[model samples]
Target: MPESWFVPTIAAPRRPIGRQVFDFDRQIVVMAIVNRTPDSFFDGGRTYGLESAVAAALAAAEAGAGWVDIGGVPFSPDTPDVAVADEIERVVPVVEAVTAVSDVVVSVDTWRADVAAACLAAGASVVNDTSGLRDPELAAVVAVSEATLVITHSRAEPHVHLRAPRYDDVVTEVRAFLAERIEHAVGLGVPESRIVIDPGHDLNKNTLHSLDLTRRFAEIAALGLPTLAAVSNKDFVGEATGLAKPDRLAPSIAAAAVCALAGARILRMHDVAASVAAATMIECILGFREPAFLAHNV
Candidate 1:
C-alpha cells in the first residue's frame, strides 16, 4: 500500500517546507494560476479582461489560494511573439486590479523583465518565469527587486519540446540545469532565500520523463531551496494513470503531496482547495499528533 499521506518520509529534508521558515510554520500554501490570456493550455480565453481577471484572482483567493499567479501572455510554446510592452500593458492593469481589492500575494508569470518590473511596481510579489531565465536580463530584474522569483527548468519552447527534448540522464541533467541556474542567479546578486525551483515537469519532458521527476521530486528539493511543482493535470498524469486532464485530480494531488512531503514548499495547483486540504491532512497525519477525532466519509 502507498504510505499514508500524513507520514512524510523518515529522511525528509532538515529544513521546513520551501516557503515556511525555520521548519515550524506549516500552513500549506496553495497558489492558483490566473492566466489572463486567450492561449494558455488550460483556462484560456476565460480571463482576458480587467473584470474577468479580477474575478479569477478573487475567486482563487476566495477558494483558499494563498497566492495567485496573474499571467498576461498566453503561455503556449507556439504563442505568438509578445512584445515586452504588450505583456506589460496586459498584466499591469490586472495586477493593479487584483491588488486593489485582495491582499493575496500576486505573482507575474512572464519571461520579460520589463513586464516583471512593471507588474512588481504595480503590486505583484513573485515572478514565475517559465523560461528559467533564458533572457539573461531577467536575473537583473530579480536581483534589483524584492519580489520572489520562480525559476523553473525548460530547455526550448514548450510545444516544440517533443522535437528538441534532449536528455541523456534526465535526473542528472535537470539537477545540473537547476544548479547552474541557481549559481547563475546567486552570481547576479539574487538571494537564494527568494528563489523557488521547479523542474519543468511537462515543459519539455515526455510522459516517462515527467513521471520519473514527479516521483522523485526530492531530488529537486535536495538543493536546499524551496521547490515549486506545477504538475497539475499534466500529460504525465494521463500517461501514468490513463486519466485525462479533468480526471487527473487524484494523481495531481498525489503528486503534490509526495513532493510536499519530500520538502517542496510551493505547490502551484489549479484545484487549490482540494490540494491544500490533502496536504494539510497529510501533514496532520505525518506529525503523529493524533487528532481528537477522525472524520471519514469512506
Candidate 2:
C-alpha cells in the first residue's frame, strides 16, 4: 500500500493489465524521447536531420527502449504559427524510419490532431499530448486512432494562456485535471483502454510542485490507468541535486528508479542507455530477478 494515496475503489472490478493502454505485459519499459526541435529544453536539435533522427531512434531501440517518443516542436505556447504540415514534416520521416526498422512501439509527441494523425499514418502507436486534452481535435484524433493517448496535467499556462496558475492543492488539482481530460476524451469516443496519464513535471512547474508530484507517483498510479512519467534530466533534477544540466545523469536515473518502484509504467527519458541500466537494476532489486551477480567488471 502507498502512504501518499490509496485506491479510491477498493472493490472496483479488476481489469487484466496485460493488454492495457501502455501494455503492462512487460516490466518497466523505457520510452526514449527523441526531441527534434531547436529548443526542447534538453537534447534539442540533436535529432534535427533525418539521419540523426533515425540514428537516435535506432540507438534508443538498441538501448532497450520498449517505445520511442519522437517529438518535433518544444510545446511552447508562445511559439509562432507552426503549421500542421511543418510538424508532420519534422517528425514523420523519423517515425517512418524508426518504425520501419524496429518492432518496438513508437509514440508521437505532439499536441495537434493533424500532426498526431500524420505521425500515426507514418507509423506511430501512441499520442503523447502535454495539454491534458485541452484541444478538442486532439481528442478526435485519439478517438479515431484509438492510440494510447497520454494526457498530462497542467495548470492554465500562466504566461501565455491568459490565466494564472492557482492551485490550493496541486496534487488534487492535477488528478482532477486528468480525470476530466479522461472523461472528455472518453466522451468523444476514446475508450478507457486508450488512455494513459502523466503528471506534468518541469514544464511550467515550480520545483516544489514537481518534487511533490514525483514523490507521490503512487497517487498517479492509483488512477487505475497506466502512468507514463516524463521526468528525464529536467530542471527538477537540478533543483534536487544542484547539478548543472550536463550533470543530471545521476538524478535522472534516481528519479526514474523511484518512479518505477512507485508504479510508473513508462519512463520518458533522454539517456535511454543509462536509464535502461538503472531500470534493470531496480527490477532486480524489486524481486523481479534472482539475487545473483556474475563477474561483470565495474
lDDT by residue for model 2 (1-298), tens: 5576432221122323212323352367789888877666676577877798889889888988888888887766665556778888889999888878778788888888899889888878789988777788888887787477888886554224533345677777788888888888899988887677899886557777788888887777777777778888887789889998889988888887777777776788888888888877866766555546767774
TM-score of each: 0.86, 0.87
Local accuracy of candidate 1 as per-residue lDDT tens digits, 112-218:
88888888889888889998888767888878877778888988853333565768878778989999998898898888767778898878878888877866776
Q: TM-score of the candidate numbered 2?
A: 0.87
Clashes of each: 1, 0
Query: Which structure among the candidates has the greatest lDDT?
Result: 2
Query: Which sections of candidate 2 miss by over 4 Å?
Result: 5-26, 77-81, 157-164, 291-298
Ten contiguous residues minimizing lDDT sum, candidate 1: 4-13
lDDT of 1: 0.75
For candidate 2, what is the lDDT? 0.76
